[model samples]
Every structure is written in C-alpha cells, then in structure tokens.
Target: MNNILNIVKHIEKSIIFILIVFLVAILVVSVVDFGLYFSRLLFYSSLEGWYEPEFLMPLFSSFLIVLIGIELLETIKAYLKDDSIHVELVILVAIIALARKIIVLDYSTMKPEKLYGLAGLILSLSVAYFLIKSAGISMKLRKKSSVDQK
Candidate 1:
C-alpha cells in the first residue's frame, strides 16, 4: 500500500512538472506577443492611439492574461513546495481573470442578466478572499500571543 501511494505521488509530481514547463513556455510566448503589440501601438499618433478602445482593450486583456499566468505559476510552485493549495492565491487569480473579462467586454451589447451574474461572482469572490485573509491573520496573531504568554 505504501509503495502504491509513493508511485501515485511520483506520478503526480511528474505531471505537475510537465504542466509547469508548458506554462512557462506559454508565458514566454505571451510576453513576447504583448511586447510586439505594444511596440506597434506606440507608433500610432500619440493620445489618439492610446484612447482607441479597439486597441486598448486587447492590450489590457493581454496584460491581465500574463498577470494571471504569473499568479497561477506562483500557486503551482506553492502547491509543489507545501503539498497544499492556497485558496487566497486561487481567489486572486480568479479576480484577475474577471477583471480581464470586464476589460474586454462590450458592455453595450451585454445582457442585464449576464452583467448581474458577473457582479454576483465578483462580490462572492471578494467576500471569500476577505474572510480567508482575516482568518489567516487572526490565526497568526493567536499563535504569537500564545507563544508570548508562555
């Protein structure tokens, strides 16, 4: 039984290592693409170029995607190190993804129901993140106080 468990654990780590390699490749490509796009955009007439929603929205979305990728990489690294998932990091990644969606969304064409759903999701994730953060802080404080009193 212990040998089987060890094999399973080794398999899991191998898969995770592969995933990390793929993710790194993707992030590198994304960063290069973003840089090329940004440089191209810079050549367009000054403030007018920056103000174009068509150009700006995609740029913002790409930037956020790269950020999300970086955050995910951190989460994966943390998991590998600690053998546990961090809820706070995952929530932050979700929030970043949502922000990216909002950035690229065409609000004028969006249905009211869809908008409401997004709002609800955002609120729920925000509340959950807050609660987790608060709990962690309180736990740390309690530990510190107990140690001090001893």
Candidate 2:
C-alpha cells in the first residue's frame, strides 16, 4: 500500500511537470508566430508598389490584427499568469467581433429595431475600450513581472 501511494505521488508530479513544459513550449512558439505575422503585415505594406494584392487589404489586415492580438494576449496570459486574461481578451475580441459584424452587416435582414441594437452593441464596445484603459487590465496585467507573482 505504501509503495502504491509513493508511485501515485511521483506520477502526479511528473504529469504536472510535463504539462507545464508543454504549456511553456506552446507559449514560446505562439509568441514567435505572433511576431512573424506582424512582420508579414508590415512587409506586405512595404511591397505594395511591387505587386497588387488580390484581397481587400483593410479587411484582411484588420482580421489579421485581431487574430494576432488575441494570440499575443493569450500567450502572455499563459507565460505570465493573471486573473484578467479573459477580460483583456474580451475587450479586443469585442472590437473584432463588431468590425466583422459591420463588414458583413445584412441590411435587408436587420429590422429598424435590430439596427438600433447593433448600433448599441457598437456603442457598448466603444465603452468597453474606455473601461479597459481605465481598468489598467491589459499588457500591464499580462506582463507583470514573474517576480511579483508571489
């Protein structure tokens, strides 16, 4: 019985260690990719004179920014633990969600009342922006020094 208990404890520790290592590796890779995607956006803009893009630049770029931003915030959250992970993400996701809504807005399907609701959503998202700034719950939270974690 004692032998079995000792083996279980060892297994638990090993499993936890493996999970942490996996998470750290994932965070490192995601951060690297985030940097790469940002650079790609810049490089594309600089090479605009050399080639005309087939896609809508603003649309794709905005979408890319949203994706990159979320990944960045998530990666930070994983490496640097915080309670505001979802809060920080929701702020940007709210903006991105609204942008996509505006981009694909179906005027015919939306009634007058629904338009008011959509507009309200947009207003709320704007308010969220101010709240995020005022709340001091962004990169500040995500990148708080690991030393301060204790």
Candidate 3:
C-alpha cells in the first residue's frame, strides 16, 4: 500500500512539473505576442487610435492575462514546495481575474442584473481575502505572544 501511494505521489509530481513547463512556454509566447502587438499598435496606428477603447482594452487585457499567468505559476511553485495549496494566493488570483474581467467588460452590452451579480462576486471575494489575511496575521501574532510568554 505504501509503495503504491509513493508511486501515485511521484506520478502526481511529474504531471505537475510538466504542467509548469507548459505554462512557462505559454507565458513566454503570450509575452512575445503582446510585445509585437504593442509595437505595431504604437508605430503603425495613428495617435488617435492609441486612446481608443477597442485598441486599449485588448492591450490591457493581454497584459493582465500575462500577470495572471505569472501568479498561477507562483501558486503552483508554492504548492510544490509546501505540499499544500495556499488559500490566500488562490483568492488573490481570483481577485485579479475578476479585476481583468471587470476592466474588459462592455457596460453598454451588459444587463443590469449581470452588473449587479459581478458586483456581488467582487464583494464576496474581497471579504474572503480580507478574512484570510486577517486570520494569518492573527495566527502569527498569537505564536509570537506565546513565545514571549515562554
């Protein structure tokens, strides 16, 4: 049984490593693509087009996608090191993703209920993140206080 468990663990780690490699490759390609697109937009497009929503929205969205990828990579690396998932990091990634969605959302096309739903989601995630962070800090403080008493 122990041997079987070990084998499963090894397989899991191998799969995770492969995922990391692929993620890194994808992120590199995305960055290069963003750079080329940006250069074209800047040098080829007119000055008026620079501030246009159609052009700027995609550009910012792409940038945020890259950032989100990096954060995911960090989360995976941390999981590998600690052998546990970090709730805080996961929540943070969720918040960033929500922010990206909100940024690129077209308010004109969106319904009122949809907007309200998104607002609720944002509030829930924000509160969850705050609570998680506060709990971590409280734990650390308790540990310190206990050590001081000792």
Candidate 4:
C-alpha cells in the first residue's frame, strides 16, 4: 500500500510538471498563431471582393482568447487539486460543444433522431443542475459529520 501511494505521488508530480510545460508551449503557440493570422488578415484586407476581415478577424481572435482562458482555468483547477469542481462548468462546456455542432452541421440533412439527441442534452443539463444543488447539500452534511466527530 505504501509503495502504491509513493508511486501515485510520483506520477502526480510528474503530471503537474508536464502540464506546466505544456501550458507554456500552448501559450507560445497561441501567440505565434495569432500573429500569423493577424498578419494575413491585414495582407488580405486590400484585395477586391475579399470578405471584410475587420469584424471577422477580431471575432475569431476574441473567441481564441476565450478558449485560452478556459484552458488556463482548467489547468489551475487541476493544479489546485480541487476535486469538487463547479458542476455548472461541466454543463456549460457540454452546452457550448453541442451548440457548436448544431450550428455547424447541415440541419437540413440531419436525421429526426438527432433532434431528440439535442433534447437529451438539454435534459442532461437539467440533471446537472440537480447535482449542483445536491453537492451543496452533501457539503453541508459533510461539515456536520466532521463537527460531530470532533
């Protein structure tokens, strides 16, 4: 048991180190990509009949910034060992991912059953709300138990 515990600790330390390194790499890559994309947008803006990138480029880059923010938050949550993450974040991520899919896919070609799947996703979010409240109750009970034990 002690050996297993030691091994697990070592693995966790290694993983945290790797995560830090990878996060730095991601930040560097994101900066480089943004610079490249912004340069291209500037170059392409002068062409005739080219889509107006003034609005599009900023919107795209802003979305990329939001994505990086989300990733950074996730990394921090992991590093802090916050085992009880906010349930709303999970629901929000699910809703965003599904909404993106529903927006991008050709709705006309989608099957009737796929509509039901979207409804299911909504139902799952509702369930997640219940869990969020239940988790609060759980914490309260845990506190009570610990106080009683003391």
Which candidate has the highest TM-score of all?
3
Give the local distance difference test score of model 1: 0.83
Candidate that scores best on lDDT: 3
- lDDT of the structure predicted as candidate 4: 0.60
TM-score of each: 0.86, 0.42, 0.87, 0.54
Backbone clashes in candidate 4 total 0
Candidate 1 minimal-lDDT segment of 10 residues = 138-147
Question: Candidate 2 lDDT, tens digit per residue, 1-150?
Answer: 656756765685576567666766765676676567657756766656433433344445555555655555564444344423455466566667666666556577878997888789888878877787788856434434333354
Instruction: Please give the distance, in angstroms, between residue 5's alpha carbon in candidate 3 and its true position after superposition.
Output: 0.4
For model 2, the stretches where C-alpha displacement exceeds 4 angstroms are 1-80, 83-86, 135-150
What value does the lDDT take at residue 73 in candidate 3?
A: 97
Off by over 4 Å in 1: 44-47, 137-150
Instruction: Indicate whether candidate 3 or candidate 4 has the larger lDDT.
Output: 3
Order the candidates by lDDT, highest first.
Answer: 3, 1, 2, 4
Clashing pairs in 4: none
Of candidate 3, the 10-residue stretch with the lowest lDDT total is 138-147
Across residues 1-150, which tens digit of lDDT does each residue of candidate 1 receive? 656766777797899999999999999999999998888788653656577798689789889989999999998887777666777888999999998898899999999999999999999999988998987642111112222344
Report the error of model 1 at residue 66, Å: 0.1
50-91, model 4: which lDDT tens digit per residue? 455544545465455646546565644554464344445555
State which candidate, 3 or 4, has the greater TM-score. Answer: 3
| Residue 38 accuracy (lDDT) in model 3 | 92
Candidate 3: misplaced stretches above 4 Å? 137-150
